[model samples]
Target: MVTVKAVVAGSFGGPEVLALVDAPDPVAGAGEVVVTVEASGVGYVDIMARRGEYGPLSVPGFTPGVEIAGVVTEVGEGVDGGWLGRRVFSQVQGGGYAQKVLVGADSLATVPEGVGAGEAVAIGVNGLVARIGLERAGVGRGDSVVVRGARGGIGLMAVQQAAALGAEVTAVVSRGRPDDRLEEFGASRVVPSAEAGASAEYDVVLDTVGGAEVGAWVSRLRPNGRFVLCGAAGGAPDTAFGEALLENYHKSPTFIAFSLGSLPGPAIVPQAQVLFEAAAAGRLRGVVQEVLPLAQAHQAHRLVEGGGLFGKVVLTP
Candidate 1:
């Protein structure tokens, strides 16, 4: 009957519906480890989950959070005893908003020395998403890539990763701070949402902001290019499928959708390990705009929904 503090949703609604509640402490089941969370990332999907927009996978009154970084406090049966007391990060299935969380052993990535918990949490979701999207898009040295929503957590990571990979990045940002931060993230060019229509074509387009903008940019891909759709921050619009088809008929540019949830548990840890190494080598960096205690989970959600933060928001307990 051990208990822990967690943010819970009694109903599917807005950020206000999140409440601090006492819940039974999580324990490591077989092949799992119980962690004392030092930080949990607050992502766009968390907001969508709170509103019940994710459909079948959604649950009511569940603790919401997808990524956490902390120290392993206990190991379940059949797990390696060496994992005990190690600091790690996980791409959790859910329940990361609590002070303690259970994580599958297969999904754990050791946090490197000198990497803070907040940055590890950021790398857990947003970092992995960027890595997968860029790899899928086949971006390489001297390739030109376009990134929509370039100021967001994932988008900024994409910009930095693309640059580190030797690709020229064109960042499409909203009218204000987003534009400025995109440049800071190493985008070679920055364009406002309105002007993206006339920008130079790219070898690949990493679109985090889907909507009419997606349809517009799909037409901007060069011959044999790729377009990776990773988020819907710009709003999901009815895509002009016919137009998209017509625009790429000759080049045969590919369109791929990406979600970290689609990956197998075992695959994520290795991918996260690569990102951690990149961050440790200074080839990748995570921006964490704010870190608040678990009691401020509601406020953190509000800030995320309102937008304009230059980095990831994290909750700690």
Candidate 2:
């Protein structure tokens, strides 16, 4: 069997659990294609997997990356021969931190011309989460939207996408020196999370960093405004559902949870394709802060957990 180098989690713990090892090159089964990956996204979900927060590790030595950009090397049974040499990006369910990965042909999004591999990887999960969350929250022209964790990968994308849609964007970032990248992404204003109460009332709230802030921000929305909760990076808080409902119904606001895993597969593919086009057109901005080799996957995780990076991190094999 031909083997490929990959980052595998030997156990559920911390970044130290991620090990670089040689694994058999994944084969393209029927209706699938094998890609020779140039870059893979290192995201919060990967960190969660490393800490065993999402669920039990499916395999002891399983690869953990969920998104990759690569060139198709082979097509499986029932797949078109034309796809064999195409450059594509995919949101794989797993097994992406390898020199090669197998994915369903239907899941592959063709990378647009002139888009760099690192940019494509940066747009992976973060872009999808932002697109879905903002759309679900009904963000559009003249609307005011608040984005929690504005300096984060998904948060930055949400800020850009919302602004492009003509919404007034208020970015709520952790207290510190402001991130110039947030303004570059089109945020109308940046405020410390502690000062979030001072932000103008918004039509929509994209809460990528959940916790006490959820309740505080939920109370800040205008009547009938929508709040989309995307991540718990700030730490999930135990809020009283009764109080939340009272605030929603009495205040005419709506609360919706956003997760790519919960959405229908067909729904996600088209959105991803749109993002790829937007990236190619220069309308979408994806900040890639670091690109580390596959052997340094553990260090990459540590950086992600340490939480000051302003953009996506790509792991190259």
Q: Estimate each model's TM-score.
A: 0.95, 0.95
Taking all chains together, the TM-score of candidate 2 against the true structure is 0.95
Lowest summed-lDDT stretch of 10 residues in model 1? 174-183
Q: Point out where model 2 deviates above 4 Å.
A: 56-59, 264-266
lDDT of 1 by residue, 165-231 (tens): 9999988776663355577778988887777666578899898878776776778889998999998
Residue-by-residue lDDT tens digits, candidate 2, 1-317:
77899888988887888888889878889999999999999888887777777663455667898889999999999999999888888887778899999888888888888788889888868999999888888788999998888888899899999999999999888768667668889999988776666446888989887877577677778888898989888677557643765856777988898778776444577888899899888999778989899999999888887887788999998
lDDT (CA) for every model shown? 0.86, 0.85
Name the regions of candidate 1 deviating beyond 4 angstroms: 177-181, 197-199
Model 1 TM-score, all chains together: 0.95
